[model samples]
Target: MKGLVIGGGVAGLRAALDIANAGFDIYLVERDYSIGGRSAQITKSYPDLTNIKDVLKPLMEEVYNHERITLLTNSEVLGLEGEAGNFKVKIEKKPRYVPDGESCEKCIEVCPVEIPNEFNERLDKRKAIFVPFSYAIPDGCVIDETNCLHFKDGSCSRCKEVCDGINFDQKAETIEIDVGSVVVATGFDPFDPNLRPELAYDKYDGVITSLELERILDEDGPTGGKIIINGKEPKSVVFAHCIGSRDKKVENPYCSRICCMYTAKEAYMLREKLPNAEISACYIDMRAFGKGCEEFYEEVQKKQVLYRRGVAAEVYSNGVNLVLRAEDTLLSEPYESAADMIVLAVGVEPKEGSSELAENLGIKMDEYGFFVEKNMYDPVETEKEGIFLAGCCQGPKDITDSILQGGAAAAKAIGLMGRHSN
Candidate 1:
């Protein structure tokens, strides 16, 4: 029996690997031009601050090369029918106009159109014909139809002229596959800090979100991992925690499990990169709940990173620094900290179209829009039989938990198909 994994993030990749290794045919569908998902955007994982790409790239290569797995990047699930052990899935495969061979610099040099790179949180621009990242799977250029000159007015075909690989006529294709079970690992969207105007995320150039900081810290990111604000290295960096999570103002009352840990990790990274810079982590509560998390927090504390118990009230840009206003709960007093930069510790939210996808799949979502599990005792199982969820698509979780759930979902899918003997 075959299995359909919706998403190509860590959880989906893990599930696909497990099922494919068990000798079952697996169809992994990803909505982006490449897989890897948000995890790929992360520079490092928490607790150990391990290089995320070092750990993930090999798994991605395995999935891409696995014989039992049919990896479909730039694809989406159009429709699904039937039940366990015999489900027909219709997928819409979008095109990446660049040809099959490795993407080269020739096409990029000729492409005149430039647009903000979404992968880099729009911190930088990229050519219309560009690879999503240096380590992008399929390792090819994808045309941004929305921004391509040829698509706009048929004005420029410079990329096509320079590179024989360009195919402007590439069209979307639909494919049907029969699978025994479905694993929804669609993942989560970073809480948009723009929603909280008080944070001044977009209003000020010095203010950025945690995810944006992740990209900025990445060696391959827009700034090549330099912690620069307005063309200058930040002398002081302030982290504002819980911008989305545990905030009744935004209707997201649940704790986004990773924010506290990731914020700490970011603080540690900042300390390492800017040894003499002042750094403070303003938080409501220190939730170092995971293994080695508390120790990591302690390490950051030992680095002289300040941990302040408070909720940031507002942030305004000064001529030279961003003034952060907040109340220290422990001190029972209000104070303002001036910083060269501010990073909002934004929370994770359900991915866009999650509610609609849940409806389409005949599943349920929690009030917060996360896919509801069968029960608290069995979190991976959805109310719908033969359907499972892994990663933030189900709830806010760390990468380790997401991978564990992926494996659990794979086991459930295998049992549902009665393939234990295989």
Candidate 2:
């Protein structure tokens, strides 16, 4: 009996690899053009500050090159039927237009259409015919039909003229497969800070989300790893925590679980990059519950990052700098802190369309749209016997916990399939 893994993020990759290594044929389905989900967008991991590329690259390479794993990029599960021991699955694979292993990169220069690069958090523009990143796994250019001129009005064919690999005629197709067990690893999306307009995330040029800052700090990122705001390096930076998490007004009352530590890490990085810049963080409470995370938080404090007990109440421009207004809970005094750049440490939310997917799969989701597990003790198992949950799809978690759950889900899948084979 074969196995199936969905979502193709770090968690999905881990699940597929673990199951495949156990001698099971596994099909890995990823909706995106590339396999490395949101984890690929990150610059570094917290606590250790290890470069994420170093950890993700080798794992992605191993999965792509594995013999027992069939990677289906730009694909989604359409339907599933049958029980734990046997199941039929249908998948829809989208056309990339550009043939695999055949990009000369000349097409990118000739393409007339440009759009916001989502992989870079819209900090830069990319041609309609372009790759998601430098080392995207299925390394080839993908034509975004939504914005491509050729697809819109057939008025432009510059990319096809320059490169023979561009095939506008390629069409999407469907595939059917059989698997004994399924693993859902669909990940989380960062909360939209615009929900809280008081922070002025949409109106200000100086305010950016933490994910955007990750791209800025990346060596291969939009700004080439420079900590620049408004085209100039900021002398002071302020971080506002819990923008979309732990707030009843937004209806997201759960702690995002990673914001505090990540903010601390970012502040530590900022200090390293700009030793003279003043750095401070406005927070409601600090929860360093992870292993070694408390030490890391203390270490960041030693780097001269001022941590104040408060929540950012408002942000307004003073014509010269951005002013953050908040009340220090301990001191019982309201104060305004001025900075050239303000980074909102946004929280994680369930992936959009998660409810639809859960309903289709005959599983249950919480009010917040996270997949509900069989029980608190059996976190990986779903209501359906053969189906399992992994990563942030179950809830907000850090990278380590996501990978851990991925392995746990894989083990459950292996166990069920092993018994069926016997």
Candidate 3:
């Protein structure tokens, strides 16, 4: 039996690995130049401050080297035909322009065009020919056609001059594959804080999102792990939680489960980096439900991280620093605080094309647009036979739950394929 897994994040990686280790052929398709997805962007994880790349890079290597698993990066499933135990999937593979087995640095060093690095949340710039991140698996460079000088006007060929790996003539390829089962593991997108103008996300220089802070804390990120804003270390930092989740104005009423814990984790990280700096996290509710989560929250509190029960009403510049006005629900009073940096703990939502993808897969979506599972008890199974789900595509969840669901989805796929053969 053969299986196909869509989306190459942690969830899809685990699902594909499980099926391959069981001696079945599996194809893992990713819509990016490389895998890793949002998890790779995180500097450290909550509950335990394990380095994000330490865990992700090793898994990525295993998947890339696995013989039974076919890694299809820069690809997406265009359409699906047939039913359970017999399926034909059409895929569109985008061109990366970098040749296989060529040194990526050779092309990158010669490329002169610079643009905002999306991987760093636009905190820095990168050459037109570059890898998504330092630890990108398959260890190669990908050309950005949109910004590459050669593609824009056919004027510059410096990258190609130094590297024989450049393939300007590469075109998008269409592929067809046969599989017995399919798993959809496309992850969620971080909520855009600009939707909440009260936070002053893009309007202020010091205002940034929690995801952007993750990159700042990362050693390979924009600032090389320095927590600085406007060329100096911040003396005061304020974290505001539930920027998108549980907010009716944006129409996202569901709780983004990871934000609370991640904000606490960021607070602790700040305490370590800036021991004397004042740190506060404004939150509506402290949902530390995961195992060891409450203990970690207490640890941050001991480090002098103030936990305020409130929501920030507005943020604005005050010449010297940014002023955050919020209501202290516990004290039943208004409070105004000053901070050099304000971090918005934005929530997660379904990826952009989720609705269209659900329709193509012949599945249903909830009111908020997350794929609906076959039944609440069967969280991994989709409404259609032989179709399964894992990770945030089903709903907002943490890394632990996503990995567990990935394994469960793989089990279901294997069992169904076995029964079909019988």
Name the top TM-score candidate. 2
Number of clashes in every candidate structure? 0, 0, 0
- By summed lDDT, the worst window of 10 consecutive residues in model 1 runs over 413-422
List candidate 1 stretches off by more than 4 Å.
419-422
Clashing pairs in 1: none
* TM-score of every candidate: 0.98, 0.99, 0.98
**List of clashing residue pairs for candidate 2:** none
Model 3 — which ten-residue stretch has the worst lDDT? Answer: 99-108
> Candidate 1 lDDT, tens digit per residue, 375-420?
9898899888888999999999999999999999998887887752
Per-residue lDDT of 125-163 in model 3, one digit per residue for the tens? 999999888888667788889899998999999988998
Query: What is the lDDT, from 0 to 100, of the residue 115 in candidate 1?
Result: 86
Highest lDDT, which number?
A: 2
Q: Order of all candidates by lDDT, from best down to worst?
A: 2, 3, 1
Candidate 3 clashes between residue pairs 3 or more apart in a chain or in different chains: none
